[model samples]
Target: MAVPKRKTSKASKRTRRTHQKASSNAVSYDSVLGVYKRSHYISPDGYYKGRKVID
Candidate 1:
């Protein structure tokens, strides 16, 4: 009971969904602990690329 005998235009369904879009995680925006984070991790009061490595 299959279908789809040919009718998926729209640039081949957006080029096969181009990886299915919709993706996040990788924030990055903490000027010395001022907001957002996640890029290379390390910021929960520990800091990393912003110096002050735990301590």
Candidate 2:
């Protein structure tokens, strides 16, 4: 088993753990549907990039 030679500092541990948490998705307001949805993603109603993709 490999062992670490030096103990990790608080800043180092926190810096590594900074991205370990869940990130919130960005939202955008749809003028056509009049609802808030995830940015750059298709809505559940099947719309993408401000246009209907599927029914």
Candidate 3:
């Protein structure tokens, strides 16, 4: 099967770059209910000092 070619726009490129830049700063995880959870205070030095959740 041949895939159709799509043209990339400058707006799309800028949006992609912005998203990449933002996501590069943190780590995210998913809870048991399948909802997305993200951390804002995590350091780029690879250490996770966030709080834990207790049942």
Enumerate clash totals for all models, in the order shown: 0, 0, 0
List residue ranges in candidate 3 displaced over 4 A: 1-4, 22-55
Instruction: Give the clash count for model 3.
Output: 0
How much is the lDDT of residue 28 in candidate 3? 70
What is candidate 2's TM-score against the reference?
0.60
- Per-residue lDDT of model 3, residues 1-55, tens digit only: 9774997788988988885654344447634334334564434333344433432
What candidate 2 gets wrong by more than 4 Å, as runs, is 6-12
**Which one is best on lDDT?**
2
What candidate 1 gets wrong by more than 4 Å, as runs, is: 1-8, 18-20, 26-36, 39-46, 49-55
Worst 10 residues of 3 by lDDT: 46-55
Per-residue accuracy of model 1 over 1-55 as CA lDDT, tens digit each: 9999999999999998899778878797889878888898887788888898887
**Candidates' lDDT values, in order?**
0.86, 0.90, 0.51
Error of 1 at 17 (Å): 2.7
Q: Compared with the true structure, what per-residue lDDT tens digits does model 2 show for residues 1-55? A: 9999999999999999998998899999998789998899888889887799988
What are the TM-scores, per candidate, against the unseen true structure? 0.28, 0.60, 0.26
Ranking by TM-score: 2, 1, 3
Who is ahead in TM-score, 1 or 3? 1
